[model samples]
Target: MKDKFEFAHGEASVIQLKDISASGRARLLDMAFARLRFSLFVMPVVSVVFVWYYGKINEDYRVLIWSALYCCAALVTFLILRLYREDQKKQSSEWLLITWLPRIQLVAAFHGLGLMVLLPMVSHTATIEFKYLFTLTLAAIVAGNATHQAPMLSVFNCFLIFSWHCTVLLMPWSFSSHWQFIMPLSVLYGIGMFKHALTSHRFFVRMIWLEEEGSRLAENFKLAKNAAETALSDKNQFLTTASHDLRQPMQAMGFLIESIIRRNIDAGLKRSLDDLKQSVRLATQMFNSLLDLSRIEAGAVDIKLRPVNLNSLIDDIALIFREEAVNRNLDLRTWNRKEKVFVIADETLLRQSITNLMHNALRYTKKGKILIATRVRGSCWEVGVWDTGMGVAIDDKEHIYSPFFRNEHAWRIDSAGHGLGLAVVARSAKFMNATYGFTSSEGRGSHFWLRLPAANSIDFSPQGLAVNNLFEEIKDFSRLTGSCLIIDDDPHVCVAWESLLWSWGVRTKCAPSGALALAVIQAGFQPQVIFCDQRLRSGESGFDVLRSLLHLYPEAHGAMISGEFNSRELEHAESEGYLVLHKPLEPDQLYAILSRWLQLKQN
Candidate 1:
């Protein structure tokens, strides 16, 4: 799965190969196998030589007995080696170490020096035959060291000492002269080999275990690293979605409170409420900026490019803040060269970018005027937002598009922003494949421009559907309203939305759960509009509820409200022609949606 091994469906199941362990046990076992193979090759040659030497000497029966014993030992050693080979084919390293190591060592030792003990007994018939026994003893010692590890070597040497003792005691007077010296040497060699074998066995066992542990640790660390990365990614995504969704309701609340305070007809109360509303709005904006950055980083924002009218868009911008501009005695004007500038772009995203620039300009500007203009320049039209505000220094220009970076002037003037507005604008420009730049003079003004390639021929033709302030239609929603079903698990959200809707003269039926909403529907409470939250307390989501309701009330307009901007939700809602309201809804935003819905219902 990780591009390590490309295994077929059944390959892994059938071929259960050993995984490499950090321990040297596997290597040690391989070395032991090699030694056995070499011993097997030498065994027959030595056996035949002993048989030939005995036959040529015309020795007594004793020599024949020694030769026969040597042959039998060699044959048994060879059989053991063959058995070991077969076992190696089936046994894993762990199995070999635990079950076969001790047995193999003892067998190898016995065969290695067993015949050498019978050598002195044949001296009466032929001393030459006794010389052959010594040669066989030396060979066994060497072969034992090579094939079987430590314990086997020790056994080999110990058996050689024991056999040599028996041979010396049985020796005839003619060969008894050197028996004492020969017996001691044999015992010393055997004891030394056994000691060394013991040491080797312990070392191999330790090394093997260490290898296994190292491999397991490596695997665990890899898994932990992947999990940490995944967690961080999810955290960033959650923060982004939460911020965006929270902004809508917060912005709506701010606007509504501001509007209510403005109509207070008392200057003191109006000022207080306005301040409160401004604080709320600023908080909402900061959260929205954070959300935007998160969404962009998560690769969740998708631009829906469509043919949009530049003039109409500019008009909408002007209308959104015309009152605020007028209130501050700042002139807001649009200079669109009397031709239609249509572009292939995401209308909402384009609006956001332009609005951010406008808002940023307005925030710093205490003065003369702000201008928005669009004109064809070569194959693209440059749409500009110019403001007489505290402009950027040349040094700070590049960094303005960096998130959380505020210029010295901006910090001195208004440091409230998350400093992500220009960054979002820049990312949007890149996403749309549009070019954007700014010309600014410190203490004088700044002009930000976006260049979008024209889509279709520029049509200056005007349409009557244009309204001066689309937001104005929202305030008049109370005049014509019907029963609205509110679905959300959060009681606070339900209460707030109901309060807002009641002012619009709408009768409300509320359900805290999707199942309850279904029960309400079954109880003959068919509302004209439905608002549902995306996540419910249980595993059920707003979509699940909407689907169920749609089956029963096909004509009922269902809208999903959430604190997340999921692509799946957007696409599904778009296909169904359902409105998606993100959280912290602004009155104007809510109004805009309601007005549109009301118009659709009328149609």
Candidate 2:
């Protein structure tokens, strides 16, 4: 009842009105009664005008009597609305029957009485008056009973009776002389009523069918939701296992790279070594992307709101995709607002959204252009990215924001994407309370736009410093000496982890399940650090093995790893005295954590 009903559906409106706020419903009822009363009061005045005009023409008294009777019926209708309004307040069925039912019966009796009395005066034939008045009596029965019970049926019958009267009136000699046309017209009216009755029956059937369809749709939605939840859970488990296993090889790779740099080697060999190191860096970037995507989808990423420079964000995105654009022979262009504009948003998420857009643009546009632009529109700042390439179809626009929903067109070009780019962008925009939408025409191009509230608190003056300089103070620790224990269920994960770590010259021991890891640990072997996956095969868990290690070696430092971005389990692990690591762990992140741990030990 609190929700407005101005543009609501008919059935929704009826239900809403049926249970409206008492004061509002009373006011509405009073209004309806007032209109009915006014109509009844004006009837005599209108009838006098008509009577005066016809007084010189027919000199008949039937019109006056009929007009008076109609006025009386209108007064009864007004009283009925008033009584019904009062009936709404009374909960006792006995009170409603004692007061309201009698009033309705009296109204119906009056209508039947008037029709019987007036029709005989108009036409002196008992048969004609009897037939017409009987029809009116049937109509009155429908009206008085229909309003309170079986209302749709009552209303339908009312329309049928009125239609029959109008059709009889239209016959050539119906009012004056010949009763011949009455027989055929009566037959036609009966046929029409039969057809209407059949239609009413069909309406009920359709209503039942629609209800069944709605229930089926609701059931399907629940199943789909559960399936999506299960898939996400499995993905997170894999990521956790992979991250723990990967740390071993990444640590070894860093150790090897650092050791090689200190060796007595020529410049050419060192340069080749640097290339290998860069390849590791690339792998680390990919690993970070996977983790970031997982965390964003799992809603584990906490967004912090701060004043962000719109122009700077767009420029950074354009720069990131510049090489890709150039390689594809696409022009990468950017335009900024004349004045510096700031918006309150999460800068990291904003950057990620823009980056996704730029990546998508560059990926699709082979020989055209990718443009990033920003402008002030009324109260909002609109940031847009456009790509001139094979555009999206009209039907694909509605589904583009769904997770893992790649358009057929995008799949044709490159099917490598997991279809999460736009989904991330949409989620980020919603979290920031920003507006996001895209426009695409067939065979032309696509343009995506995000509008955010312009913020007044941020400093937008250019710093004239590149983002690369932001990390200049960060030192590299390529030559780290350590041994690690990696536990995971997946063999491919173990292979990748070991290779990455061996490249860094760190010794490693890997076990596919926690039971096997426990067996190895019991034989008197322990690494400097231990990394265990949360989910292991054979119903054995990393937490179980880690607990066993802690009991055996009380001073051992351990980290629990998961591929999933869901941090609830990780948080629980951290609370239980374990360092928690997210899956798809980057080489840099692994190095950073190990470097800090080693430094603490050395100190």
Candidate 3:
């Protein structure tokens, strides 16, 4: 057996594998195996039927011929099955194809030849029936097996020519003169079949190539997508880490400067200190703006939607810019309808977006009035800011909302602008599902607007009155007194908070970790306010520390402070009902919170 297999491999390599490449040989093998398997299964039953029918007409030698044909078919089936099994072992794909494909084709050729040989043996009395059966069987082979054998077109052509010649030879030429015409037509049909098989072979090869290419492209696309996602994740992490590390010293500097400004000094020296403070504030604002843009691009901004009073929201935004506009001697006017207008939106984001538009308006318009107004348009409300400044050119309008893209006109107007405000506005508006655009003509002015879906009217009068009276109930910070506890891993942050708190006439204690804060509380230092950093040096979160201390000191007003702004952390802190302060806390903001806590304690 081993010797026979070795001989077969040698013959296959010389005859077929030498003529065709490895892939072509493999494909031919696949096609041959499929056709052979189908023939092996169906041909025996067909042979039995043919024998029984012919035996009724010629019983003498019909059994002998059928037995011979059956035994030949059985041998071929056994040989083909064994080859197929050997192929399945995958010893060597190239060797298997070369060895087995010829065997499969040889078996198919014999099966066709055997059927052709049987046609002439049928009795002449049943010539019509014999003709019908022969033609039907030939047609079946041409239609079904021809296409599957296309990968080896030579085998298909050989089968077609053999079947056609056999049919022509068995024709009853003496009985009918027209039978002479059948030979020529049979030749034409065989030619057509061979042509079709060639076409099918080309098409099959093309399809295989296309399928392989598509699979390769899909795999490449998946790898590229994974790499891009990993890069984006790394960028977000770096920004988060950098923001936290950079803000610690900035926070300390802000508090120290505030303490100095509060002391008695000459007017000129006070002006110098105030100028230094303004510079610090400007730096902080630019840093925060860049951070905001990064967060928005990283998909870290969360939108919280509720029914918002558009009129009041606009009023609040206008108030924030009114002082800045006044300092520049520009009129900041807000015009809204007498009736309340409401829209469903994230109030904080909506406010920020509109504030960005107002800031741009105030920055560009040196002397012209800035008008912020609301108007109804169809089913939407348009909150627009119009500034009589140098309008945008035609080409600049398209790229105006891109990050860090400043127009020539804008550059001349304010070198301090980082060109991120409008980018943030565009991103935030999209997040809230609001549409924003502008109408401008150069040398006239630009009107930037945001359109929001209008909601059904409801009474916001009570809420408006409560908001109006919030600042009226302020407590003087000097009268407020409370001891505060600070938990932060950064020594600079701890020192900054403690100094700022003590300067406000409040007693303060500091701990570097949650365990140490617990120790301080155990030592009987009761704090009215507890401020914790969100991230610590010991790989523990400030939230965990706050939770632990709150359990021990439930009466303490707890707040989480950090330099970095993350949506997940913000949501977590809010859900836990803890006040969150961003890093580089302003002195007035700290005093306000402490005074509120102190007032609550007194009550």
Which candidate number has the best lDDT? 3
* Runs with alpha carbons beyond 4 Å of true place in candidate 1: 1-41, 49-71, 74-102, 115-207, 222-491, 498-559, 564-570, 584-603
Report the error of model 3 at residue 206, Å. Answer: 2.7
Candidate 1 Cα deviation (angstroms), residue 465: 17
By TM-score, the better pick of 1 and 2 is 1
lDDT of 3 by residue, 173-274 (tens): 422545666667766777777667766765555455445557778989989988888888788778877887877887788877776766637787987887
The estimated TM-scores of all candidates read 0.48, 0.45, 0.56
Task: Sort all candidates by lDDT, best to worst.
Answer: 3, 1, 2
In order of listing, the candidates' clash counts read: 16, 19, 0
Q: Give the per-residue lDDT digits (tens) of candidate 2, residues 371-407.
A: 8998888888889999887777888888988999987
Residue 410 accuracy (lDDT) in model 1: 75
Question: Which lDDT tens digits does candidate 1 get at residues 115-172?
Answer: 4444545455655544746545554645365336432233334344444434444544
